[model samples]
Target: MSDMTMTAAVEAALPKAPFEGRHLIDGIWRGSDNGESFDRTSPSHGILVSRSARAGRAETEAAIGAARKAFDDGRWSRISGKERATLLLKVADLIEANVERMALLETLESGKPISQARGEISGAADLWRYAASLARTMHGDSHNSLGEDMLAMVLKEPIGVVSIITPWNFPFWILSQKLPFALAAGCTCVIKPSEMTPSTTVILGELLLQAGLPVGVVNIVLGFGQPVGALMAEHPDVDMVSFTGSTAVGKAIAAAASVTLKKVALELGGKNPQVVFPDADLESAADAITFGVYFNAGECCNSGSRIIVHEDIADTLVEKVVALSKKVAFGDPLNPETQVGAIISQAHQEKIAGYVKDALAAGARVKLGGAPVSHPGLPGRFFAPTVVTGVTADMAIAREEVFGPVLSVLTFRTLEEAIALTNDAAYGLSAGVWSENVHTCLAFARRAEAGTVWTNTWMDGFPEVAFGGYKQSGQGRENGHYGLEEFLEIKSVVMRVGRTRSNWVRA
Candidate 1:
């Protein structure tokens, strides 16, 4: 009985693991210059979970320089693919061993449920293993037909130093998808994690050192976006920039990198669509839609904020969605039974609430939720699950990314209309087609303007599958062999078997 109460008390308190410290450079933890620091707040508690060093322009520059020097001086880039593969697999083993600690940190920093955090840990570990195999498979090309008796081959080499700027949402997962593959491709990186959530990133940097990565190969500059990320984006020493965030900021990064003619890969935001056909199983469709929009408190880049449903089943789907929304339990993230946790911040929660207000002002009806709940007793930043029906294609709430638990419901008639509605957005990261017919699924896959198209599945991603966006959603893939290439550059090596250039021309 005493042990059970202890568990209950732990659950009630929502005990968050602390990671109060500064940036890690050259395998050492160091504070920011001028003794500067920033607080990382938990959405579940709205209090500082940890205090980390906030890098200024000088610190950012220092990190970039350190990374450049690491790549130029260290043997990481010159290491054979087989050796790199071995180290990568070792890192994967370490991450798997420490999965619980990482998961708890993620849960505390992001206010996601602990169970979900564990799943993220597993997914991240899988990426490391995938990248390890890809390291050995990181080959360019060799050809015999280029010239008779001539040997010509291409080498995919590291693109010097890289700056990876990740956002607050999915910090661990995004960095996992990025850093492992970058290291696999023999590239050193200086990272600037989102200021809002920096605890896990800082801790993971420490873990990399423990896993045998060389000093300065992975530097952390934990600070705000404007100075830290912006300066890194335009840094001349940086060879490439891989960003995962909003499209607006991605454009700025692209512009910044263009000045130096460096490579840039962006995995930006999306107003992704979820199409529910009349023939889709309403039970499964409602469950899928509920999780699609509300997972991570609708903070995901590919969250299905816009739901385009067939007019034949619109009312029925709405009813089923309302029922499912009622069943979604919300509370402290540490509780295993809590399906929904707090939004990332109070400002973000209010931002999501404003969408519901505007949707109502635009003549849409709130099918369910559409309100905010205050837990004055609890420290977490919580918001209600909301669904707005009677939405049109052009409405701001339907078109813009709410990035909250609010979902907009709109109806369509024909296949063209459905496809047109799905394609109408300015962003196209991911999309889903809910149907039992193979023909319709194939057609949607062909026509949908998205990097990832899921048939009857929403928000499904694995380590092996390549993920990114088209157009404004951002460039490049994030997983598997495709992602490893983003951190590499190709060069052609030409050789002749028996003839010298001068001898062949003059004789």
Candidate 2:
């Protein structure tokens, strides 16, 4: 499509006005004390999309104080499981009801396809619902058989106030992953959404309020990491910090939170790989590989950005993947038919192009697109779907995350070689193996170092399954019951029955 035609279509779909957002502290919506604010322009449309309050140290500390008071006062932390579950379910209902509103804003701010953004928002509702179920089922253990005179009990309790920092790629969904689960576990929280995509999270705060969440139980401060996020991580009142972003930032948050010995949960970067075998379904594998790389334009932490294929079928697999990549639509995110959307920002676009350029300079071959694309009407930045061949384990493109719709192809001669190449990177977020043979799939699944392994598939996620990473990818899991446990602490109690305990001191 011509750039002008695309631009016209996108412009027609743009919202009449940008969203206005503010911090939610102690159940009240308010602007930054200094009246500071920041605006976000749609990366695809090149128009203003949101203006959010820019929080500073004072706002950050206020949010922390509110959460701390809420937790200590038992406003939410001591609530009944049934009560917490009821409120969470209401929030889930609200999320579903507002899917269209949230999704449109998300697509505008994050530059993901509208369909994908809708799916993310809808999927987030399920996370909230799953967390509600967890609230009801959460339990502790009783040691009735320990002894007649000495009985014991193991209890699970909320870990107190939590600092939740979410990323822009999946702002609403990632926040849902942490917030609802923390609430379900009886932990009050202070959230800091990525400044680039802060609207959807603010809208979520509205839903939370409508759900009748207790005052001070959930607070949000919108701003950059320096004053807002850094304070959240370092606050002594925060019992734990849950962050999802780059590995470097995760490390910094961990270090800052370490001074107080607070618990830290990080979901960081990934250079996830999908291994293709000679006996695998080439067509399915190729399609999945294309989808995996292009989904969210490859901004996902679990993105199958790299692939290790059996040397014998490497050429055939690459050919099939390139063909599929060409078929996937790429354009403005507002267009529902568009499969891959704009780059998140100009800087990120440059980063992606630089990776492909460096790979070519380092002797790698571009099987498909290797440059930026321009559409007539859209003012946003876009990159062509890229496929780089001749990628070796040692190349930066092979190990580092390009975070664009780019794929790196590496060849392996044997199962051992494929596994070695898959685990060669510092990240162990996710891995996939495509083979019809059950034994081969089992072997790969058992050996892959990633937190989640897919056989005959890629990126199939569920609220029932736990998601996270290993090694540098991250620490701690999100989703399912394990997600709820991340916000909880264990306590053991021992008691003497009927005053049967004896004193050791000679009194």
Best by the lDDT measure = 2
* Residue-level lDDT tens digits of model 2 in 103-155: 99999999888999999898888999999999999999989887788789899
TM-scores, one per candidate: 0.94, 0.98
Choose the strongest candidate by TM-score. 2
Q: In model 1, which regions exceed 4 Å deviation?
A: 1-18, 500-507
TM-score of 2: 0.98
The weakest ten consecutive residues by lDDT in model 2 span 1-10
Model 1, residue 123: displacement in angstroms?
Answer: 2.2
In model 2, how large is the Cα lDDT of residue 345? 86
For residue 364, model 1's alpha carbon misses the true position, in angstroms, by 1.0
